[model samples]
Target: MIEVSKGIYWVGAIDWEIRDFHGYATPKGTTYNAYLIVDEKVALVDTVKEPFRDELLSRVGEIVDPAKIDYVIVNHLERDHFGSFAQVMDVAKNAKVYASGRGKKGIEEVYGERWDVTAVKTGDTLGLGKRTLRFVETPMLHWPDSMFTYVEPDRVLISSDAFGQHVAGSQRFDREADPHALMEDAKTYYANILMPFGTLIQGLLAKVPSLNLAPEIIAPDHGLIWTKPGTIIDAYGRWSKFEARDKVVIAYDTMWESTGKMAHLIARGAIDGGVEVKLFHLRKSPYSEAVTEIQDAKAFIIGSPTLNNGLFPTVGGFLYYLKGLKPKHKIATAFGSYGWMGGAVKEIVARLKEMELELAEPALDLRYPVTKQQEQECIEFGRKIAKQVKEAKQ
Candidate 1:
């Protein structure tokens, strides 16, 4: 409940263990972020998780009488952002709840009609004495009603979750964290959550810049606030453009030791070729986690062992979900082990194409037990991917 700036307060979870988020099956702890802006008119940007309701109330009290708060801006309809709305009403009964048209029903479905819920459109402004919050509708940002709130005087943008990560901590700003840790945290968040919405993100980035509004603070619903402003703007520009990394995501679903061996050496080949690599055993790694890690990589390689005359169900499921999001602008390849029913390779290749990734080469499909020849093929595949990444200068 501490104030992060003159009149801005941090009211989000600071859990160190929440690595996963969005009900997306994350392996990392996540924060349900909220903010309180005390100005000519008191405005609260979203609310915390249910248990944190009292804390939110206490914080608002510190700024002024809760009843003095003129508006409660609902940036995202997800429960993590509005779970405490009921509690808030008890204090600020007259406060109006602002949300996009798409979010109103979601909130109604969750909380029912209990207060003034105004469904606004893009570019709607709410003036509260000296402060004005302009709302921007950004649908399909993982949700139909996701929105961004811009505070005029402070030049603060409450970008619900657009540039946010699932980083867990009490650190309010990235400047306080280790740079490497912050990068990983931010990267993972973008990959897992924002990857599927790449096109929408790109559009939003362009739209915001044209608005010519420079935000000194980008207070997202999760992770650190962008106090440096351009820091995250630059990051969003790079990530939304699918900026390539000198890395590859070697995501696999292995059976027996055959496919496992291939994944290990392929990663080695990539490393030897001077490319960074991340290996995620699909069975052990959640798709959300892998997606986040894959976001910045210049290339993607998926390996799976054949089962039931088809690709492993998990691998198939991941592709189906990822396809819906339409991740693109990267080179991709496939590799895996098979027995009599050698269908994994074809299935993987098809899935990669489904995501519209630029095909690299014919998949290196291996037969079971991985003959010495097949193992060497895995190494060559890694080398090829490395060379491709290096050549791409990602």
Candidate 2:
């Protein structure tokens, strides 16, 4: 176990083989971080996945006997963070579990009240001798049962999932990883999982200051801990506000080369208009990565070929995925090429509207095998989006 503070230890398991988290890609794998605080009273904050239960217990044994654990603090009821709960309880049979109100209900619903669990709320504190664990409710920061555990005197924040990244490494702290790469992973994780909760995140960022919850070390349930808390705190502030850059992301899926050609031409136009452009062929790229690019882009253009009188399966699936993410304050439009009749562009526009993204222009559709004229029009459409993105930046 790595010591994060005087008495706080990181006893999490690193998952180097995991490549998929539900649907979100985790190419770099991830860690299920559980912190161990050994003061007068012993507390285990969170647990690893069920498969990593042995690793967790072993880590706990490095510092103290698992049976000696006095309290099991569950900051989130999500399985990734609490999957080893049953096994941990089996060993620490006398330890009591503490979680948020909704968290307590969720635990009982799943485990049937077989264990002793206490419901906590914001401002609640659990005295662990010199160090105290303070509770803060952060509902819908991805899950209804989510919350954070702040360790006093140590000034360590055991953030459940916030500021987490899907990355695995022997290094435990942010300072150990390349700053840019770490931030990129963090952005990808946030874009895929927490993008929809931007407003709630903004509220939480504001609330932290009011609660005087400043942390010298910020430990999340996944990835590396933050020794320099300001970097991640500032990043969360920007991301939660949906602050964007002068960039455009073009995502498309093509049955033939028509839509692909359009995507390339559009990207060219946007680049020419002095905006950074990221182009993704949805079939060839991960939706999680695409959303990460879109998260920072001021505008995004999506294209899909018609399939069965609707959107292409990949495009349709991506739209539903993007819709749930609820990205805001962005300009968007749809474009596509269809065979006999066109429906993909219309459907794409409808989905964009449903997402509440401002349409920079009407959805553009070209007949099968776009003519040179239509190709030029696609370029102009891209230019228009780039202009809109620049204007938004201003």
Candidate 3:
């Protein structure tokens, strides 16, 4: 166990073997962070996943007896945070559980009404001698039951999932991890998991300042603790506003070589047009990674080869995933090659429109094997997108 603050310790588990979280990829795995705040009344904030119950308890046992925990704070009721609830409550038999109103209801619904739980709201405070724990209801900051616990006098904010990364390592704080790598992991986590709730995040960020929560340290439920809270908070501010850089993202899947050729030529034009370009073959790369690149990109161009008069399976699936994310303020267009009949490009354009992305150009489609002339058209297509991206940035 590592001491995060003077008396508060990190009693969490590292899941280095997990390569995937639901559908989001976790190449470096992740950590389920739980904080143990030792004061006049010992309070254990959050718990690890069910599989890591032994590791979590072992760390807590080192500081104090598991049964001695006086209060259990449920920051979030999601399975990853609450999976070991039964085991923890079993050990800390006399500990009182405190959670957001929705969190308490969710806990009761899932585990029944056997345990003693107190429903809390925003502005609620619990005193433990020198430190005071303040609750802030942050619904849909990713989850409805999500909340943050601010430890006053210590100036630490135990954030549920906000400002978190899906990374696991021996390091316990941002200072110990490579700055660039840590931020990239945090970006990927945000793109895949929290992209749909940008507006809510903006509101939360504004609320934090007004509530006078000037946290010196921000401890999230995943990844490392943020010693420099402003770094992540600044990034979150830009992201929550859907801010974009002068970059273009091209993603496609080809049945043969036709669509692949178009993607490469388009990428070349975008590169030559003086903007950053990220190209992805959906079948070969993880969708999570492509989404991360698109998160801050000014424009997105998608290509697909028709199969049985419909979108290529990979492209269609990617669009479905992208639609759910609801990426905003992006310039998007579609292109494809078809045999006999053309329908894939139209479907792609429709989906893009459904997501409310601005269409940069009319959907481009070429027949069967793309000729030399059609290839130049693809190059021009990329150049046009690059121009749009640059113009948007200006």
Cα lDDT of model 2 by residue, 84-174, tens digit = 8999999998999999999999999998989889999999999999989999999998789999999998899998999999999898999
Ranked by TM-score from best down, the candidates are 3, 2, 1
Q: What's each prediction's TM-score?
A: 0.90, 0.98, 0.99
TM-score of 1: 0.90
- Per-residue error for 326 in candidate 1, Å, reads 2.5
TM-score of 2: 0.98
Model 1: per-residue Cα lDDT over 99-205, one tens digit each: 99988888788778977799988778888767778888889886898888888877888899777877666577878878787777777777767777777777877
Query: At residue 136, what lDDT does model 2 achieve?
Result: 93
* lDDT ranking of the models: 3, 2, 1
- Superposed on all Cα atoms, the candidates' RMSDs to the truth, in angstroms, are 2.5, 1.0, 0.9
Worst 10 residues of 1 by lDDT: 18-27
Per-model lDDT: 0.79, 0.92, 0.92
- Pairs that clash in candidate 2: none
> What lDDT score goes with residue 41 in model 3?
96
How high is the lDDT of residue 153 in model 2? 86
Could you tell me the lDDT of residue 249 within candidate 3? Answer: 94
Per-residue C-alpha lDDT of model 3 across residues 1-394, encoded as one tens digit per residue: 5999999999999999999899888999999999999999999999989999999999999999999999999999887888998899999999999999999999999888988899999989999889999999998878889999999999999999999999989999999989999999999999998999999988888887788799999999999999999999999988878898999999999988898988999898889888899999999999999999999999998999989888999999999999999899999999889988889999999999899989987778989888999888888888888888888842
